[model samples]
Target: MDDLFAPATGAWQRVSPRLATVRRIVIAAIAAPVVIAGIVLAVLLPDQRWIGAAVTVATLPLAAWGGVWAGHNQRTWGYVENADDLLVTRGVMFKRLVAIPYGRMQFVDVQAGPLARAFGIATVTLHTASTETAADIPGLPSDEATRLRNRLTELGESRGAGL
Candidate 1:
């Protein structure tokens, strides 16, 4: 059963280890404010103190769990490029494997949000004729993301020419 979720046997390139830190930071950034608000409300509103306290108590642990989960999830994301296709595998519980043929790629995009940019990581997205075929691989280093985008574009153009 564990083998089912393991990455395929090949030259699987793992995303940068720093991605885990980025995920934890993002989770904390989002969770901290909400928890703080709950705590403040608990102190300010005496009548609804119980509700606020409950919310604050419940959320803090959940937020920590989310950070841990994000770290683990980031570690799970990996990709491998073969002669004919690129394989991306992710998820720990509901594992998924997406195989995108080089010939099926229509375009490639590289993006980085403020948080990602600060972390020096970017996401590479692949577009195909079928919207369902489009895929994204996040948490790549900026330079690696650029190289991948260029490589995928080149491969897509050369391979898709026949299609």
Candidate 2:
């Protein structure tokens, strides 16, 4: 059970550690506003102050939980590139491992939202013929994300030529 999500014994590359901070920031950004709104509503409408207080109190735990989960989730993500395919593994409780063959890749996309850009991280999305086969790896440094996208596109084209 303890080793359920452990990395494979190979050259698995971990994403940038700053991703934890990014996650926490995102969670706070979303949760803080809601909590603040609730507090302000309570102050403005004394008749419904209890409801607002309740909402605010309830959200605090959920926000904290979200931050913690994000940190753990970020730590669990990793990828490995082999001669034939790329392997992505993640999840803390329900672990998942996906093997994407280079020959099957159709295209790659690199995206970075404002928060991710601020953190200097990006996500690389891979599109294959089938939507179900698509995979993405997030939290890579900006440069690494671009490099990976280009490399995967090139490999996909070259390997797919023989197919």
Candidate 3:
């Protein structure tokens, strides 16, 4: 059982923090308009009262599910640099584990929103050879994200040179 979860050689290191409460708040804030719209639809839409009510009620579960999903999804940001590849695993239910060879790295980016800045957190996005398959490792400390980016960049470059 231990071996099943244990990482192989050059196992993953958690280089990022969990998404902060402020980040959750930011998401909720952005969702406020939709929430309000649902409420208005439930109240003002007379003919479709039942439908509107159902939709409004549905949002409650949706919001709860979304929060839990994000919380669990961002619970861990794993980075494993193997001899020839890097692997990142994230998400809880809809899990995604991405493997990228050093040669496949295009670039890396670090981003911080206002809420993240308030909480001193950042997100690191890794761009790979595939345009749509970017890795978004979020909710890290600003300094840590920067350090990881620099380290990963150096590693990628070194591997590129070796090849």
Candidate 4:
């Protein structure tokens, strides 16, 4: 199972560590509401206080685990621009490696939501002839995302991808 993608083969470029910060923020945003709801419920319905306490207790640990997972998961993402293709690798237990040949690329997109923009990170999506091959790499710094988009576009054109 682990032999699928040899992670040691290339000089992989890692996304900024701040990617963890952005992901942690998202996790906290989601968890806080649940905890707040639990607190509110406890205050409003004393008879169901156990439910609220359970919710708070469960949510707090899960949120903390998510924050830790975010950092570990962020470290798993890496990409390498090979001579003929761009390779992206991610995941921990169920790992995946996507190799997008320059000639097969139809377009490249860079996106940043409001929170991501504030965190200075973005996601780069690669579109190919087959929708199944489409992949997105997130947590790239804003500038790197732009540079990667431009480089891929240029490479695709030069490789006669006809984009």
Candidate 5:
């Protein structure tokens, strides 16, 4: 388990912890309302108290599990930029590893959503001619994301991989 999807040469570079925080926040933002409404529904409609309790019961544990899963999932994400390719590895139960050659890179993009921007984190995506090779590394500090995009772009250009 410790070496699942481990890089071949160097150690994997992990994404920021803020990625987990942002995911947890999003989960809470979505789940909190459901929980609150469940309680409110229970209070307002005593005759349907079971329905409200069911909603709360069903959502609370799932949301809690999502929060924990977010943390663990974030920890699982990692990437490494090798001499000729970039490798990304993620997932827990069902793991994935992606390797994209610099010569095959079409472009690199950096994106940040409202919450990610607030946390100064961004996602770096690599586009290739092959749809199967497209990949994204999320929860990188904004600066790092920018740097990675730029570096990948430069590498792609040098390798004549630019589209």
Candidate 6:
């Protein structure tokens, strides 16, 4: 019985390796240059050594924050396509697993930001009848997002049509 479900389970386990939000990357990337510049300027200013030291201290926190952001960017919960439902799980601190039944799904949206477009990725936001149970699955290839959106929409409409 367990073997019977292995293939299905394996399919769900296959997730995009790069699922971090481009927003996270962009923020980190931007911070690196700014922090470096600040540190350089601080070192060059002899009279304002105290102010420079303050700026350098502030950079420490930003560096720590960037590290955390990078860690989050690397972690992604992939989409699961079961026979009758779709599931998405993600998050590190506040882990969430959202299951959307075919009949309950109203629409599926594909979202891409400027950075996401550059990275060739998109997020699939699934809307169901319940607001609280909505699912936002990120780090999908744009094509995959579109395919899933279409498939889910078809499933939902077909199921809803019967009712």
User: Which candidate comes out best when scored by lDDT?
Assistant: 5
Q: How much does candidate 1 score in TM-score?
A: 0.90
Q: Which candidate is the best by TM-score?
A: 5
Determine which window of 10 residues in candidate 6 has minimal summed lDDT: 1-10
Output the better candidate (4/5) by lDDT.
5
Candidate 3 lDDT (Cα, 0 to 1): 0.71
In model 1, pairs of residues that clash are none
Sorted on lDDT, highest at the top, how do the candidates line up?
5, 4, 2, 1, 3, 6
lDDT (CA) per prediction: 0.83, 0.85, 0.71, 0.90, 0.93, 0.70
lDDT of 5 by residue, 1-163 (tens): 6565778889899999999999999999999999999999999999989888999999999999999999999998999999999999998898999999999999888899999999999999899988899999999999899889989999999999874
Candidate 6 lDDT tens digits, 80-160? 787788877665566566777788887788888887878887888888777977888777888888888888888988888
Q: TM-score for all predictions?
A: 0.90, 0.89, 0.73, 0.93, 0.95, 0.73
The parts of candidate 2 lying over 4 Å away from their true place are 1-9, 161-163
Per-residue lDDT of 127 in model 6:
84
Please give, for residues 117-162, the per-residue lDDT of candidate 4 as tens digits. Answer: 9989999999999987778889999999999999999999999986
lDDT by residue (tens digit), candidate 2, 1-163: 6455444556678899888889888789888998998899899999889977988998899999988898899888889888888888878788787788899987888999998998899999888888777788999999999888878988988896222
Pick out the ten consecutive residues of candidate 3 with the lowest summed lDDT.
15-24
Judge candidate 1 at residue 125 and give its lDDT.
Answer: 92
For residues 11-118, write the lDDT of model 3, one tens digit per residue: 667643446476457567756666777778878888887766776677667777767766666665676767776677775545567777777777888898877887
Q: Model 4: which residue pairs collide? A: none
lDDT of 6: 0.70
Query: In candidate 6, residue 72 scores what lDDT?
Result: 69
